[model samples]
Target: MLSIVSIGLVGLPVNAQPLYPTPDPDVFYTPPAELAALKPGDVVRARKIDTGMYVGTEGWQVAFRSTNSMSKPVMGVTTVLLPIGVKNPPLVSYQALINSLGTQCNPSRSLFNGELQDAAGAMLPIGRGWAVSLPDYLGPTSAYGAARLSGMMTLDSVRAVQKVAELGLANSPVALAGYSGGGMATSWAAALQPTYAPDLKLTAAVAGGIPADLEEMALSLGFAPHPGFGLAFAAAMGLEREYPEKLPISDQLNENGLWFREFTHDACRRFLLFHGAFRNAEQMAASKSLMDSPVAREVLRQNSLRHFDGIPSVPVFMWQGRFDELTFFPPVAEVADRYCRAGARLEFRPYEIAEHMTTAVAGFADAWNYVEARFRGEPAPTTC
Candidate 1:
């Protein structure tokens, strides 16, 4: 029996909230035993409850809390398993890529900065019928710790979902999928899964236009057009959130990295969209020395997925567009090559005609087809 718990219904008042510093953990909730055992076909709707954050075996488990927009008392659902059985259907986790600065602030929109409502303004298709746990892993850190927190949040959410499932809350296998920054999160989660959630049975991961190497991406975007500047700003926020010591700014950027944090939190996404690829990391930093400094390098290193080595515990399906001017092809190819060489069950699909966004949108069908085939017990494609 699937059960839905309605969490708190707080009005969205325009208040200045700190970004980099972590929020109060009390705001979240853990899945109760009764609520966790929700089955694939069962559906229960509750309102004004909270899915508290639980510390997973790997890292901190972030809570994905949201109020149902339509109903009073804000009904929020938890662990609704979609029946696509294969004994234990592989539990697929969807991580939305980074699209805008304030992306996470809006519950109606996707973490990838896509609209939650469709053109008809209906709730966007959230892989509802699919056996998947799509967590808004960005949490409150969307504008701050974009990549690292995203990775941690993604992995922890998978663990959280698994925990709920293991307690007889849901029944399914596990896999992961994401695009752009989400792709980055999925990559990191895959890398960490072997050590983090070894028994979760993650069979595959699909990521598109993944920003694997943050440093290279930052450098690439730092000098480009207007969009680069927005990326740089976003990177700064990420760096400040993940590694506070790396910030060069005295008080605003410094002081435990929380003071002027709010300024960048909501602003970063809009800045990126408005600027749209004009500037890069080099341009964002006030001085060239800061750009070349070791701290900067360290910040870039921490945000990147390249530092994590070894093939994932599960097979990986990665796609990138040759014309993807945003993330580029070479880096994507390099990561794919490395993973393949490491004997990963890797399917590196490149589209000759598609750009970044178009490639991801167009490739979803193929990606899902691959996922469905795997879920139905189809053999994985040979790496060679």
Candidate 2:
């Protein structure tokens, strides 16, 4: 059974139902009725995708028409749900570093085009007629962590598009894409479609600069110095969301571990931006003795991608830069090898000159091309 602390209702733990629910309708703010008739444009507006728990919150499911094709629709989405204040938008708001952990450290200047730069370094608009963006802040399972929940969130976002279509609001073919953490979500959605939502036709998926193996990342970051501290912070937050049992603290922590946990959660992007300049995880661990507990080790063990049992059911395109310091190449290679051996169709591409940032930027074009071909009813491309 799931439990949710009702918002603004102090000390009352309510039994959360399986289907996502709405907060108190009386207090929840509904979108202005005028927004229903507005077409996609420069301004970002607040709109409710569903009625229940997803209401009141800034979280929204929005539609953007594709410029290239009137009939086709592509969905742009992310898992970060909180309303980003202009003074302090959440780290996930930045499109380029959306997948990276430390976004809050370096906030972007432009809200509309902050992280949406393409390979050529030009601004891409969320115009009427090409792709619809769904800021799926509810995340997978309307919560974070647990890969399967993330997958469900992605699938549901697509379902949201179909729901809008049924109401004569919009229609478009969906090409799911996300970078870094968003990439992980997209990958899970593609893989889970065969069983979870087989009726939804997912043309293709693009997962660039993916951190396929979380455990390896933890192990690597745990042993590294400064950046490792940041990684440890990310791990703690991820574990807390996915596997709270592994958290050592019961009633919220106050120690160095807790301090780092809060700091990392609040400033994940800052840590990533400066991770390479600092020492690896080992140096930091030695100084702080952060990983001294068995619980920390167990968190790494549980959150690692190695714990996953099978390859995704659909064809996947994975790109990794050889020089990526944040997420190394070995674990990604291992995942690709395992999936390929499992007879799962996978296109694994390695960029010799690409690092974490460049890998996603450079590979995104190809990823989109691959998806376009698939959506045109072409056969799956050969795995590289």
Candidate 3:
């Protein structure tokens, strides 16, 4: 049940949740002084909050203990939303694709502000009386591209909720859901769950728009000035937060690259899309060949979702747009091939007309249905 968790709630409450974004306070997210003594899912503190979610829900902001890319203790925030009339509902950790370097972009804050990143993905589950967990899988610092850290936070968020006696979800069947950035986090959580947090009841994982390989994307992506290029640069900057010693942005960037950093440091996903609209990513760096170094390769390799020691312990449902601009389809197909060869239970769906952003809503039916079937204890279907 993964019921081994602790919670300390405060009387703090948001007075009429802001309709606009607000700064994420450090007081709730700061790691506890006694972090060394706490476990991964332990809730440091929780606050009751109001959310304008499409599905009627009662919400709470949970700050829980989770590990980072460096395997050090860190605190992350997740919003636990229960359907107003559901009782003892199954749980789904909805890892929204939060692609910004800004703190205000986190889902815990964004949802309350009436911004739904992929609410369509959660509608079906919540409609069928399923509890939803919105985790900031990138951690409180928004380590956007750190694969391992994102997964760890995802798994820990589930564990945090199972222990909340007030939520009444003890031993509930759990599923993981996300798109793009959230997809990367969902895949990693599936890979890491067997060994990391085996006590919980993990069912199926629904992820769309996952970037299978970062190292390949780094070396091969065209350097032409495009909106997509800005995303790549932003990911590199995000990676630096988790791997400062390895990425070394300040040391590697030229004058233009420095401005790119300042432009994106606190920028949200929407702003990041055009930060490099006229600037070339290759020219931004002091040395165009910086990504060719062995150190850089190793770092990217460590963070790529393409390579895993073994197949995930649980079933996975993956969907991607054939013409996805953010995360291409072939690499994802290659990963699917590997899983099929390994005899893992994977259902990979490729959309003919959907792109990166549209695939989440385009394939929401299949994704949520897969999760619902799992919750019903139905036999998992495979497309291997």
- Sorted by lDDT (best first), the order is 3, 1, 2
Instruction: Evaluate all candidate structures by whole-model CA lDDT and list the values in order.
Output: 0.50, 0.44, 0.75
Compared with the true structure, model 1 gives a TM-score of 0.69
Cα RMSDs of all predictions?
11.7, 11.9, 9.2
- Per-residue lDDT of candidate 3, residues 168-206 (tens digit): 888889999888888999988987888888876699998
Candidate 3's error at 24, in angstroms? Answer: 3.2
Worst 10 residues of 3 by lDDT: 1-10
How would you encode candidate 2's per-residue C-alpha lDDT over 1-384 as one tens digit per residue? Answer: 000101112221233122111221421222343533533221122244332232222334343221111111222233222332222221111123332232221112112323323312211212112333434322321223334555554564555544442223233455666666556666666666776676666556667666666555544444334533443444444444444434422123334433443434433334433543443433222133444445445444443344555466666777888777766677777777877888877788888854566777788778766765665667877573
In TM-score terms, which candidate is top?
A: 3
Candidate 2 — what's its lDDT? 0.44
lDDT of 1 at 211: 73
Model 2 vs. true fold: TM: 0.62
Pairs in clash, predicted candidate 3:
none
